[model samples]
Target chain A: MKIGIIGATGKSGSKIVTEALNRGHQVTALVRNKDKATKLFGGTVTIIAKDAFDITKQDLTNLDVVIDAFSVPLGKHLAYQHIDLAVHLVHLLRETETPRLVFILGAGSLQTDDGLLLDQLKKIPDSQAWIDTPESQTHELDFLRTVTNVNWVGVSPAASFVDGPKTDYALGKDHVLYDANQKSEVSTGTMAVAILDELENPSVHQARFTIRNK
Target chain B: MKIGIIGATGKSGSKIVTEALNRGHQVTALVRNKDKATKLFGGTVTIIAKDAFDITKQDLTNLDVVIDAFSVPLGKHLAYQHIDLAVHLVHLLRETETPRLVFILGAGSLQTDDGLLLDQLKKIPDSQAWIDTPESQTHELDFLRTVTNVNWVGVSPAASFVDGPKTDYALGKDHVLYDANQKSEVSTGTMAVAILDELENPSVHQARFTIRNK
Candidate 1:
């Protein structure tokens, strides 16, 4: 498979690039800084530095799948930036003839009993830094859902998304991710694996699902 | 109308108490800290100090509407402390024969196309702090929707929840609130008014709705 990863230098994005490469798939690492990408990712994959929106159909024309791990800061109000990127990507991918998209979403959108989004994050303290990232991801998901022509899958993490290796976990659609103790904690490696699996198998098309340790 | 305001000493909770009082409604302010309640609220309404979990039918036996402004953190890996409070309040309200519940929710649960929670926010430079509170409120809405016996309405503010007088904005259900400019914003005072009006009129029952400028 040919894969293009946006924000390939990011913690989670880098994992996706490496894992895709390790699987013997051809990977194009889309990044903002080539120097940072080289320092973090080394010369393991093909690296392309371009603005997410500026990348034309020619940029994505040959890729079988596009994985966006692009990031902005936590707590910066950039709904338009994120949403713009998603909308632009949908447009760009459609024009480029790309068929599949796999998005990294936040755990906050999991269904409460009545289907209200858990994005308000009242359960988490305000002092934490990563809280806002979920909101940005959710906004992008909303925009993507409006694009019916695009086949996309939005994957959210568990409530506690710590940095660690993958574990034995299960996945559920439109629900919270639970671990062996039924607690929600997912590692980035597992999340990337789940994304790659989804990218390969093509389930959960145009839907959102969560993955956690079983 | 007779209204009960839970967690009436915190920032938004205290504001709820005042709004209920100003609207000429009989208000019962529930809180844990009597000293803070006394110092901050100063007897503008009836104050009942008790552990939120211990709130009983007798405490709410007389109220017509319960505006649960009470809140607790979602904890490190927990959904929210308020989830228990919401469940407890619904249980008590059902026993006490109270008819309606008006909950203040965070916007985190608002859905994008991929069904991600909007509240899982990432900070973008030049964004405001108030934009993320709606996600938490959305979680509360989810908890409230599970109860069949209680009539409830969850009010989520726009992306920017400004503190000001009422503006009489338009209302939306299960979608982001956007203005003519496509940017979303709302005032806390207007959110209070809309919630109060919903309590009095009782439209869009058992659903989550949003408020934004006209």
Candidate 2:
């Protein structure tokens, strides 16, 4: 399948690109920095260097799937870009089912005993600096829920998302999943595998699913 | 004040353009049809012919206020454009305080004795034909509420938005308002006056207000 990954040079995005290529699927890295993408992928993947906001329908028409792994740096005041980019992409893809969109969301949107994980994050000391990232992503999921005509799905990581290799994973809908050891976390590799598995098999639609290392 | 009105050729939008012109403010008709706008206002208002989605921030930077009076016709399958266009305008104006945005929303988002007016609208027989308009507008308001950095406000007319001249009007926040004789309606003229008054006085901020004939 032809796959386009926005923010393909980012942490989780690079892993997804590698996983997709290893599976023999064609990959297109949609990034703002062509030099960085070429350096990272080393001519293994096609690169379209354009800001996410400037990506047009013509650029996405040939792809079977598009993964939105776009992120703003934590502690920056530009976290609202998460929600803005999501809305831009969704608006461009309205009334179509092809080129399925997969949004990589944050764990803050997951359900917890004390309501949303975002509610707890707000209580942490000095969370104001980075809280907007999760809050904007939470709003992104909420906006996606109202959309019915678009073929889109959201994925949320567990409380701790870190860089690591693949592992056996557990999946839950809307909730914060805990492993047997009472840890709620997922690695970049596990997330990539779970996302590719879901894309190939196609289970969830217009809703969010969470993953944790099991 | 210089003001821009999207959909200035439409029913309520035309009235707004007239009211703004009457108040001696320079009005620009940011419309899709230049001929139609020219036929409506002739040389009275400057016209920028472009799709609402294609409207850019550069075109809006000079205006003191931009009224989003864009609408899709009833019973059309393109009702989702309401939410899409709202998101587009808000995204363009993010992180800015200039060019206050006034969104002309639907009453379906207003609260009623039974949950929301949208819930009641959904129960009407054969409403499927026109329900998408209200449903999408409701979602538009939901999306706007999450935006914090933009200087935006929403105005919803009463249950029966009709074509007539301006009259005595009363305002309420969030809830559906009714007139003394139990009619829930507002003339396009009243809506225009109320909107112009609000734009001039700047009473509401980052919230929605409803109006009815009193």
Candidate 3:
């Protein structure tokens, strides 16, 4: 399968690229910094140097799947881009079902025993600095729910998303998943694996799912 | 004030153009059909012929307010354009307080004593044909509510929006308004007046309001 990964040089994006390549799939790295993408993936992947907002339908029509792993640094006042870029991509892909879109959402949208995880996050001391990203991603999922004609799905990580190797993963829908030890965490490698498996097997559609390391 | 109306030749849009011009404000008619716009507001208003999606930030930066009266014909498959165009315009105007936006939304999003008016709209007999318009407009309001950086306000008319001259109007926030006669209705002229009044007075920032005939 031909796969395109937006923000292919970022944390989860880079890992998804490697995982797709290791599975013998053709990978296209859509990145703003060609130099950084080339340094990260070298000659193994195709690189399209453009901002996520500038990616056109022509660039995506040839692929079987596109993973939106785009992220922004916290406290930059640029968090709204999460929702904006999702809308842009969905608008471009309306009335089509070929290139499946996988939006890497945030855990704040996940349901907790109390209300949303976002409600708890808002209560964290000084959470105002980085709360906008998760809040906007929650809105992103809300917007996606209204879309019916597009073939899109959302994947959210657990409360503690960190950098590590793959492990046995547990998957759930719309809720905060936890391991037996009560740890709600997922590594980038596990996320990449779960996303790839879902892409190949195709279970969830038009809804979001969450992943946690076992 | 310099005002731009996106659907300057349509029902509510034409009335808005007339009302703005009557108030001695400079009006720019932004329409897709140049001939229709010229025929509607010949010599009285400036015209920019372009699709709402094609409108750019540079085109809007000069205007004090841009009224998004864009609408699709009922029963057409183009209802999603409501949310899509709103997202596009909001994305362009992000981080700028200038060019305050007034969105002409549908009454489906207004609150009833039971729940959303959209819930009642869904129960109408054989409503599948035209329900998409209101459904998508409701989603459009949902998307706009998430946006905090943009200076945008939404206006929803009453249950039966019709063609008529101006009338004394009553306003309410987030709920369906009813006249003393127990009828929920509003004329295009009344909607136009309420919108222009809101735009001039600079009230109701980043929120939604509904209007009905008194």
Candidate 4:
């Protein structure tokens, strides 16, 4: 299958691109800088360099799937770009079934036994400096929930999302997933594997699911 | 004050444009067709011909306010355009106070004694034909409520919005407004006056308000 990965030079995006290529699927790296993408992928993938907002429906018509791994820095402004870009892509694909969308959202929206994960995150010391990204991503999912005509799926990582390699992982819907050790964590590679597996098999539709390293 | 009215050729937009001009304010009609705007306003207002989605922050930089009176037909595709356009405009004006954005929302989002006004509208027989517009507008307000960075305001009319001459009206926030006769209605003229009155006085900020003929 053909795949397009937005923010293909970012941490999660690069992993997803590598995993997709290893799976023998054709990959297109949709990034803002062709030089960076070419350096990273080394001609292993097609590169479309432009702002994600400038990507048109025509550019996505031929792909089988588009993974939105776009992420903003933790402690800067423009966190609202998460929701803005999601709305932009959703608007472009309204009522279309082909070229399914896979959005990587934060775990802030997950429901916990006590309350929302975001509620707990907000209670953390010094969380205000970077809380807008999760809050905006929550709004992104809220906006996506209202869209019934699009073929889209959302994935949320565990509470302690970090950098690592793939491992045995468990999948659940709308909850902060925890492993047997009561640890809630997922690696970028683990997320990539789970997302690629789902994109290839196609289980979820217009719904959000979560993953954690088991 | 110099103002920009999107969908300036529509029922609500036309009325608002006329009211603004009559009040001796400079108005710029941001419309899709120069001919339609010229025919309606007789070149009384400056015209910027473009789709509402294509409207940019540069086009709005000089204005004191922007009234998004953009509306789609009752029962056709692109009903989602309402929410889409709102997101687009709000996205362009984030973190800015200049050109305060005013959204002309639908009455469906109003709270009622039972639940939301949209919940009742959804149960109406044959409402499936035109319910998408209200549903999208409701989503539009829901989306707006999460936005805190943008200087914005939203206005919803009474349950029965119609076209007529100006009249005295009362204002409320959130709930569906009703007159002494228990009739829920507002003419385009009355809505125009209430909206312009709010714009000029700058009472409501970062919130939604409703109005009905007194």
Candidate 5:
């Protein structure tokens, strides 16, 4: 499978590229800087040097999947670039034979007992920069659902994600997964594994899934 | 005014220190690490070392105001610590002459259009991690309202915050603040200004305020 990653130089995207390559999949890294891409990801994967929104119009439909591991840095433009890229990718995917689109979403859109989009992020402290992304991502997800015949999966990480080993964590649907004490935690590696595995299994088709370590 | 700040090492706490000092208020930084206390913030500010939970027994009742900037890294722990710390702070504040106990809360407690707590966050694309802290911050806000005499103010940040300059943001009551286009963004500096201003003015006393950049 030839996969195109939108933010391949980011922390999460770099891992996604590594995992995709380890699985023997042909990977294309879409990034703004080739030097940073070379420094961060080495030479194992092919690189696409373009802004997230301005990729050369190729037949992206022939690709197996497009994983948006792209993350806008803390002080960059709000979810502006992210939404633009996702919408463009959706349009590009519509032209391709690719059957699935997987996005690495933040955990902000989950519901509490009150059933409101948890837009008021207070619990997962380290990822406060993500607080704004969910509101825009929610808009993007809403847009994606309106499009017909494009299968999409939004994979949100747990409340706390540390850069660590792959723990092969469990997955939860609709509800935020909590441990025995009802705490939610996951590693970035395990989250990448879950998304990639779902790409192969299709259990979480057209739905959002959360990953957490017990 | 002599002010004591718990969680002085956190984003909110550091701001409290800066704001209080900038306003010519005598400030004390209550932290867990003495070395980081000297490095991150300098020595002119008095540094008191203690666990967040242990502050209840400290002689904080004499200070003009006690701001529990102390927050568990939402990504590191669920809202358990936040709830526990708030509950304890409320009880301790009741014993002191200080009339106000300001809490930096998560946006999960804010009421949505449906009049429910926006606790579910996984549905949102980028904020999955905040489900824990925001949910817990909501609980703390509710608990603060039940107490008498000790005025509590819960300050929830808008969608995204970064190391940006203070842009003179606006304040919303019980609802999330939005820009002209309804998108929410706030600089940490402006959030600090709003919070410290609230501390002096006492508007929205015994309630919560959501802040976003203009």
Candidate 6:
């Protein structure tokens, strides 16, 4: 299958690229920093150097799935790009079914017994600086929910997303996922594997799903 | 004030362009069809030919206000362009306060005595074929209300938005506006006048307002 990974040099993106390549799918790293992307992939991947918002449909043509693994560190002034980029990509794909989009969103939009996870995060210590990304991402999913003409799905990692290796994954929907001991976590490798698995075998449609390392 | 009107050849836009000109404000008509727009304005208005979705900040740089009066005939195909174009324009002005945007929205998003006006519109016979435009525009407003950084203000005409000459106008917020006769209606001329008044006076900010023929 043909695939494009936006922000493919980032943590989750690099893992997804590796997982996709290991499964023999052709991967194109759609990125802005060609030097960093080339260094990260060691010239093993195809590259398209352009800002995500500037990416045109012609650049997206011939792909089966476009994984939006784009991310910025939390608290960045430009955190709103998370929502802006999602809307830009959706606008490009309107009224089309090909090149299914997979968005990597945060858990803020997920519903818990209390309410939205975003509400809970706001109450945490020093969440102000980092909460904008989650708020913007939650808004991204909200915007995506209103769009039906495009083929799109969103994936959210567990509450404690970390940089680590893959594990057997547990998939859930619209809630904070937890293990028996109430531990909620998902490593980048586990997220990549679960995402690749979903891309290979389509399950959910026009909705988001959550994954946890099990 | 220097104002730019998207869809300046359309019913509402043409009127707004004329109103802005009559009020002594410089106006630019950002439109798709150059010939039609030139025929409409007769060389009185400056014209920038391009699809609304393709409009860039460079084209809008010097404008003090951008009136997004772009609309499709009720029930037209590709109605989702309403939301897509709004998203595109907002993305262009993200994190900036300049170029205060004025969106001409449908009354479907307004509140009714029972619930959202869109709920009532959905029950109308054969609404499926034409409801997409209002639905998308309502979603457009929803998306805009979520934005905080951009200087955006939306205006929804009354329940019965018709094309006619200007009359005494009354402005309200959120709810569908009605006159003493219990008639909820607004002419394109009235809408244009109210918009120009708002642009010159800067009444509303980051929220939506409604207008009706009084």
**Taking the candidates one at a time, how many backbone clashes does each contain?**
43, 0, 0, 0, 35, 1
Error of model 1, residue B140, in angstroms: 27
Ranking by DockQ: 4, 3, 2, 6, 1, 5
Looking at model 3 chain B, which ten-residue stretch has the lowest summed lDDT?
Answer: B194-203
DockQ of 2: 0.73
Model 6, residue B101: C-alpha shift (Å) = 0.5
Estimated TM-score per prediction? 0.49, 0.99, 0.98, 0.98, 0.48, 0.98
Range of the 10 consecutive residues with the lowest summed lDDT in candidate 6 chain A:
A37-46
Question: Residue A71 of candidate 6: its Cα lDDT?
Answer: 94
lDDT of 2 at A200: 92
lDDT of 2 by residue, A1-214 (tens): 9999999999899999999999999999999999999999998999999989999999999999999999989988888899889988988899999899999999999999989999999999999989999999999998899889889999999999999999999999999999878899999999999999999999999999999998
Expressed as tens digits, the lDDT of each residue in B1-214 for candidate 6 is: 8899999999899889888889899889999999999888887888999998889989988989898989888767788888888888998998889899999999999999999999999999998988988899999998898889899999999999899999989999999998889999999999989998888788899999999998
* Candidate that beats the other on lDDT, 1 or 4, i.e. the better one: 4
How do the residues A133-172 of candidate 3 rate in per-residue lDDT, one tens digit apiece?
9999999999999999999999999999999999989999
Per-residue lDDT of candidate 1, residues B1-214 (tens digit): 8788887776567666677788788877888988888887676778889887667778876888877776654332223344435655664554233557777776666665546446336444432344323343454565455444467777777767777777768998877777879888887778777877777677777778888867
Model 1 C-alpha lDDT per residue in residues A40-76, reported as the tens digit of each score: 7677778888777566668887888888777776665
Clashing pairs in 4: none
TM-score of decoy 4 = 0.98
Whole-model lDDT, model 6:
0.92
Give the least accurate 10-residue stretch of model 2 chain A, judged by summed lDDT.
Answer: A75-84
User: Model 1, residue B42: displacement in angstroms?
Assistant: 69
Model 6 agreement with the true structure over A13-128: per-residue lDDT tens digits: 99999999999999999999999988888767899999998999998878999999999988987778888899888888888998999999998998888999999999999999
Worst 10 residues of 3 chain A by lDDT: A71-80
Q: Each model's fnat?
A: 0.00, 0.53, 0.73, 0.87, 0.00, 0.47
lDDT of each: 0.70, 0.94, 0.94, 0.93, 0.70, 0.92
lDDT of 2 at A20: 98
Interface RMSD of each: 16.6, 1.0, 0.6, 0.6, 19.8, 1.1
